[model samples]
Each structure stands twice: as C-alpha cells, then as structure tokens.
Target chain A: MSWLWGAVIFWLAAWAFNVWLANRPVARSRAVQLFIPALFGVTLLILWEGIVRGLDVPGVILPAPSAIWATIRASLPVLAGDFVQTILKGALSGYLIGCGAAVLTAIAIDRSPFLQRGLLPIGNFVAALPIVGIAPILVMWFGFDWQSKAAVVVVMVFFPVLVNTVAGLAASERMQRDLMATWGASYWQTLVKLRLPAAMPFIFNGLKIATTLALIGAIVAEFFGSPTRGMGFRISTAVGQLSLDMVWAEIAVAALAGSAFYGVVALIEKGVTFWHPSQRGRT
Target chain B: MKDTAGIATPVIEAKGMGLTFETNDGPVHALKDVNLTVGKGEFVSFIGPSGCGKTTFLRAIAALEHPTEGTLTVNGMTPDAARQARAYGYVFQAAGLYPWRTIAGNIRLPLEIMGFSRDEQEERVERVLALVDLDGFGRKFPWQLSGGMQQRASIARALAFDADILLMDEPFGALDEIVRDRLNEEVLKLWARTEKTIGFVTHSIPEAVYLSTRIVVMSPRPGRITDVIESPLPKDRPLDIRDSPEFIAIAHRVREGLRAGHGDEV
Candidate 1:
C-alpha cells in the first residue's frame, strides 16, 4: 500500500516536471530532448515496478521489472543467438533484397503504362494478404529455418516500397521536365539527373516505413516454424513453460532492436534528404 | 552575315501557325494564323493579355509544343531538329532552380548534359556567374538565395551553354518592380555582351518597349497578332529613357494595342 502511494506521488511529480520542461521559453538542446524522454521512460518503469510489487501479482501472469531484468542478465547468450539469427540473418537480408527489388520494379513500372496498370493492382492485392496467411505457406516452402522468415519479411516489405518509389518517380515538376527537354536530354539522362534526385525524399519515406515491417514480419514468421532459436520461438515456448520473466525480457530486446533499426534508417534519411524542405531547421 | 541595315539572317520563322488543344469541355484554340520572323541578334518581345498564346508560341519554338497546322522553323530546320542541335536556351517565369543543387551546380547542368569536359564546364559556369553579377555565390543552394538572386542564377544557367538563341517566358513577371527594373538593366547588358538572338515574352508595356527592338502585340481567345510595333529607341538605353518622348509614344501604342485586344473579346 505504501509502495502504491509512493508511485502515485512520483507519477504526479514527474508529470509536473515534464510539463514545466515543455513550457520553458528557451529552446531545448539535443541533450534535453534525449533527457526528457529518458526521464519519462524511467518514471514509467518505476511506477510499473512499484505497482506490481504492491499488488503482489503472480509472476506467471506479469513478472515485475526486476525479475525481467534478472532473466535478461541470466539469458544474455541465448538472447544474442536469437538476435543474430532473427534480426541480422533474416530481417536485414530481406530488407536489402526486398527494397532493392522494389526499387527496380518501380522503375520498370514507371517506364511502361501497361506495367503500371497491371502490376500496381497486383501489388496492392499482395499487400492486403495477411502475414499470418503468408507465413505458414512460406515456412512450408522454404523449410523451418531463417530462410522462411526472410521470405516472409520480403513479402511484407515489397509492396510499401514499390508503391512509394512509383509515386516518387512521378514527383519531378513539369517545368523541370521542360528544362531537360530544352537541353535535348535523353530519357535515361533525364531520369538519372532530375527524376531520381527529386524522388529521394519519397524513397526515404518508404524505406523508413519498411524497417519496422521487416522486423515484425521476420519475428512473427519465426512463430510459424523456426530452428528452435529465435525471439518468436523463445517467446512461444517460454509462455508454455510459464516463464513470464523470459517473455518480458524477449519483449524488451525486441523493443530495443526495433527502435535501433528505425533510428538508423531515420539518420540515413536525414543525411540523404538533407535538402528536403521537411529537413529544414526549426525556428 | 549582316546586311546593309545590319540585320542578320532570320533565326526563327513561323507562317500561318495554328494549335488547338482538346480539353474535356471542347477544343480550345490556343493560337491561330500566327506569322512572325525573328532575325539573328534581335531582341523581340511578345506582349499580350493572359491566355494570349505568347507562352504557347515560345513553347513551340522550344519544341515543347507542336502546331497542328502551318509551319514553324528554328535556324532553317524543324523545331525538333533544332532542339536536337541544342541551338537555344530557355528561361521560365519561375526560377525553377533545383533546391538540391548549388548555384554553380545548376549552371553546370546543361553543360554536363551536352557532355562538356569538366574544365570547360567550370570555365563557362564562372563566366555566366560573372555575367549575371552573381560572382562568389557559386556554392549557395537555391533556397539560401533571395528570390531575385535565384532568378538570376536561373538566367546564368541558360547563359552557361552559350546557345546562339535564348527564349524567355515572362522571366521577371513575379518579381517586385525594383528587382524587375534592376534585372531588366542586367539583361540588356547581358544581351549586349553576348549578341544572342532573344525572344522575350511579357505583359508589361514598359518592359516590352524598354527591352525589345520589335514588340508583337497579340489578342486572346484564338490568339492572333493585332499589332507589331517597331521600337525606334536606340540600343543604348538608360533607366530614364522611359521618360523620353519616343519611349512614351511606344508605350502608348502598346497600351492602345492591348485595349484593342480586350475590345475584340467584348
């Protein structure tokens, strides 16, 4: 009961601090921007820890944060193996192959009206198919290894990137095209010089959207069938064994990995599309 | 070769030119029975109200638009062939500089496309930047520059290839009067220095009178030429030349021609 009361007071105090920091007249530095989110996250963790302990919740249902942390420290090698197998081998490779194939297909689609009319609808249909439906079939075909997981990620990522790149190919302004025409530029020259550069922002937008999808598809597909050593496999088996702390630890690893993947892509987008209007400095 | 009156050979010739666009409403006649000739080293202005096909005519010359009837030629060849030969540079109303490119990068684009060597591209970019009085602004991005400066950078882009003929479509129409006047002077100086044949389009009477040796006045709604005023103003014009009697007479004639175009619509 005392722990619950302490958590309530701490939550109120942290909320007040965040509001005060946000309302400050001076602009926040990079450190403050990072610090504020970290503080909020810590406060939530504290509240979560206090409430579960005070309530005396059963570990099988929801383990306390300390138990989760202990499980994470104890199972570091197993987590590392799962991370490499699922993320580096399956998700990252599929991301590269899917994104590359999508870009090329987008170019071909842009070149031909027939392909645009025919393939886009087909692509949309593929995107609409649920990952659950595709995952089982892919596992059946590719066997119960990382290859099946990668195949699922590829299917999940392809359509978003294809649609975005197709749209980006059409992003060049009319006047810019006219300028190229006046120069007597060939079709290839115009595409390389004007259209591709104009498409950078939209392409990056598609790439960023695909990063999360790749991870989700790779992990979820592993649940259909994996080599007994993935985040998804561990999560499922841990739940059956009633090791809720292990499940929480896997969730934490997934959260960190997903965030790092998204952050890296966002950082690359910042570097590549720095001239975009959206990338301009805030007043 | 210049004739006795110092007039060079015809660079652009149009005869009975017509264009009709099929929009959803109906077929809109953009130009009809247009006839004109622009000689080498001449500064000709096409002045008319909005939708008068001045821009349409310019686009035709650039090979961006095709005439459904009649014949038009650039440098004694088809507009398409002339475009393939890279005989002209075109400047649009907006600056149209790519924001991603630096000022020098924008200027180098045409040169690069034409497969000019790196050294020559650098040389021409420097020359055109100096010509536009944008020296030392080579590294700045388009968005970092003022609107007027961006337009000048675009002009420098057109000038970099050193094409014999230049076509401009209301290039300064968006600028404030002060910037317009300043750019007008700089353009005249550029024309004097380069001796390139120029076809300029504008709606402003003073701008037409000040910059053009010949002004082709056009009317809209099946656009047709109503008057072709030959300016007697000398080549060396000061800003105060607008106050002179000859300038005023030309301006008045332009205004009357514009009013006549409106009257025809009514």
Candidate 2:
C-alpha cells in the first residue's frame, strides 16, 4: 500500500517536472534534451525500486532495480562474454555481411531490368518470412553456434537493406540524369558520381533500420540454440533458475547495446549525409 | 555580328526536324518540320506557348531526345557524335545543381568528366564562378543559396568546360521578374565575353526580345516554327533597354507571333 502511494507521488512529480520543462522558454540545448530523458529514466528506476522493495515483492515475480543493478555489477565477466558472443561475434558480423550483400545485390538489380522485375518480389517474400520460422532451420543447418545466429541476423536484415538501396539507386532526379547525359557520362561513371552519392541518405535509412534488426535477430536466434553462452541463453536459463535479477540485467545490456548500435549508425549517417535536407542543421 | 550569312559554318543546323512521342493518349507531336540554323557566336532564343516543343528542340540538339524524322547537327556532326565530343553544355529549366556538391564542385563536374587536369579544373572553376558573379559562393552548397544564386552557379557550371555551344531550356523561367532581369543582363555579358553560340528557350516575349539576336516563335499542337524575328538592338543591352522603342518593337513582334500561334490553335 505504501509502495503504491510512493509510486503515485513519484509519477505525479516526474510528470509535473516534464510538463514544466516542456513549457519553459529556455533554449532546448543538447544538454537539456539529454538531461530530460536521463531524468525520466532515473525517476522510473527509483519508482520501480521503491515499489518493489516497499511491496516486498517476491524475487521470482519481479526483482527490485537494486537487485538487478547488483547482479549486473557482480556478473560483469559473464555479461561481457555474452555481449561479445551475441553482439560482437553474431550481430556485427552478420550486419556487415548482410548489408554488404544487399548493397551489391541492389546494384545488380539496378543494372538489369530483368533482375529488378524478378528479384524484388522474391526479396519482398523473403523479408515477410517470420524470424521464428527460419531461426531453428538455420540453427540446424549451420549448427548451434554463433554462425547460425549470424545467419538468422543476415536473413532478417537482407531484404530491408536491399529494397532501400534499390530504391535509392533510382532516386536520382530526371534533370540530374539528363545533365549527366549532356556531359556524355558513361553509365558506370554516372552511377559512380551521381546515383550512388544521391542514394546515400536512403541507404543510411536502411542501415539504421538494419542495426536494430540485426541485434534482435542475433539475440532471438540464440533462444533456439547457442554454445552455453549468449544473452539469450543466459536469459532463458536465468528464468528456469528463478533468477529474475539476472534476466533483468541481461535486458539492460541488450537495451544499451541496441541503443549504442543505432546511435553510432545515426551519427555516421549525419556525417556522411550532411548535405541532405533532413540533415541540414549542425554543419 | 548579325550578318552570319556565308560566314563560318553554322554552329547548329536543323532541317525538317520533328519528334512525335508515343503516349497512352496516342501519338503527341512535340515538334514538326522545324527548320533553323544557328550561326557561330549567335544568341538565338525560341519562344512559344506550352507544348510548342521549344524545349524538345533544345533537348534534340543536346542529344537527350531523338528526332523521329529529318535531321539535326551540331558543329557539322550528328547530335550524338557532337555530345560525345562534348561540343556543348546544357542547362535545364530548373538549376539542376546536385545538392550534395558545392558550387565549385558542380562547376567542376564536366571538367572532371572530360579528364581535365586538376589545375585546369581549378582555374576554369574560378573563371566561370567570376563569370556568373558567384565568385565567393563557390564553397556553398546548392540548397544554401537562393534560387537565383543557384541558377547562376548552374550557369557557372555550364560555362566551366568552355564548350563552343550552350543550350539553355528556359533557365530563368522559375525566377522572379527582378532576378530574371538581372540574370538576363548577366547572360548578355556572358555571351559577349565567351562568344559561344547559345540556343535559349523562353516563354516570355520581353525575355526573348531582350536576350536573343534572333527569336524563333513556334505554335503548339504539331509544334512548328511560325515566325523568326531578328533583334536590331545593339550588343550591349542594359536592363532599361526593354523600355526602348526598338526593344518594345521586337517585343511586340514576338507578342504578335505568339498570338498568331495561339490563334492557329483556336
């Protein structure tokens, strides 16, 4: 009862603070923007801690935030291993391979009318396939290692990147192409100089989307099979052992990793596509 | 300069040139029996109502669109061969400068494609930037510039490669009247400096009269040349020249030519 009251008060306080911040006339500096979200996150954790501890909730049902934090601190080596296995070995490698292959395939499709007509529909079909439906089969085919996880990530990521890149390749304006033609630019030269550069914004959009997809695929693929190590494997085993704190800790790592991955890609996009209208500010 | 007859060979020659586009609504004749010759260092403007194939004719000269019948040549070569030889620079209706590139980079595009040395590209880029009066704006992106400035940067780009012929399809049509007038004066000065044969397309009577040594007026619906008016105005033209009697007379003739073309439609 006290926990519920504390939660209500905290929620109201946080909400009022956020509303006040939102209405303020002060410049929305980068620090303020970041501070608001960080404050909200901290408030939520504090409320979570207060509610769980005050209510004396069973550890199996929902561990307190403090317990989760403790678990994270205590199991650094193990968490680092899972991070390396799931993120470094599986997601990163698969993201690179899948995105590279998709870009190459998109270029091929752009070059040939026949392939564009034939392959895009097939790519769409492949993208529609459920990850769960394909994960087990990939695990069986590639054996229950990081390779199978990478394969699942690849399958999950390939189509989006391919479709976006193909669209981007055709994104050059008609006048721009005519200008190239007037210069007597060869097909290859035009592709290199005009189409490819013009495609960067769209291609970055696809890459940003693929980053999260890769992480999700890698983590989820390990649910089917993994080599006694990985965030997914530990999460599954932690539940059976009734170590809810461990599960929460794994979730925290995954969330952080996913966010970092996306942030890095977005930063790169901002750098590369600074000329784009969408990326106009902060030269 | 007006007496181009029996001088050096005409820079562009079109004989019975026609183009019919096959559309869903049946064949649309964009140009028909277009006969014209543009002499060396001449500034020729084509004026007509919409769908009169003025742009199509300019595009045909650029080898961007093929003429279905008759013949057109640039500098004694077929349009395609002349394009391959990089005989001309073309400016579209909109200033189609790539947004990703700076003004200097846009100007250097043709030079890079033509395999000009880096030093030569830099020199030409500087010269053309000065020509267009966008000297300090070379480092700015296209989107950062105003529409008029962007168009000037595009003109700088066209002038960079030093092509003997420049084909412009309503290049200043999108600008406001003030910017258009300023650019018109600059274009005259550019022509005087470069002496390149220019084929300009415009819908404005005053624009045609003020800019061209000769204005070829055409009608729509099976587009064909209706009349050609030779401007007797002097080479040096000020913005106030449009108020001159000679300029007004040429403008009136162009207006009459345009009305006659529209009357044929009615």
Per-residue lDDT of model 2, residues A1-283, tens digit only: 7876887699789878987986786527777778788878988888888888888889888889889899999999999999999999999999999999999999999999999899999989989999999999999999988999999998888999998999899899999999999999989889988999999999999999999999999999998989999998999899889888999999999999999999999999998889988999765
Off by over 4 Å in 2: A1-8, A21-27, A281-283, B1-7, B264-266
Any residue pairs clashing in model 2, and if so which? none
Q: What is the DockQ of each candidate?
A: 0.83, 0.85
Residue range B1-266, candidate 1, lDDT tens digits: 11125457989988899999999999999999998888899999999999999999999999999999899999999999999999999999999998888999999999999999999999999999999999999999999999999999999999898899999999999999999999999999999999999999998999999999989999999898888888899999999999999999999999998899889555
Would you give the TM-score of chain B in model 2? 0.96
lDDT of 1 by residue, A120-220 (tens): 99989999999999999999999999888889989989999999999999999999999999999999999999999899899988999999999999989
True interface contacts reproduced, per candidate: 0.74, 0.79
- For model 2, the docking class works out as high
Lowest summed lDDT window (length 10), candidate 1 chain A = A23-32
Q: Model 1 scores what on Cα lDDT?
A: 0.92
TM-score of every candidate's chain A: 0.95, 0.94
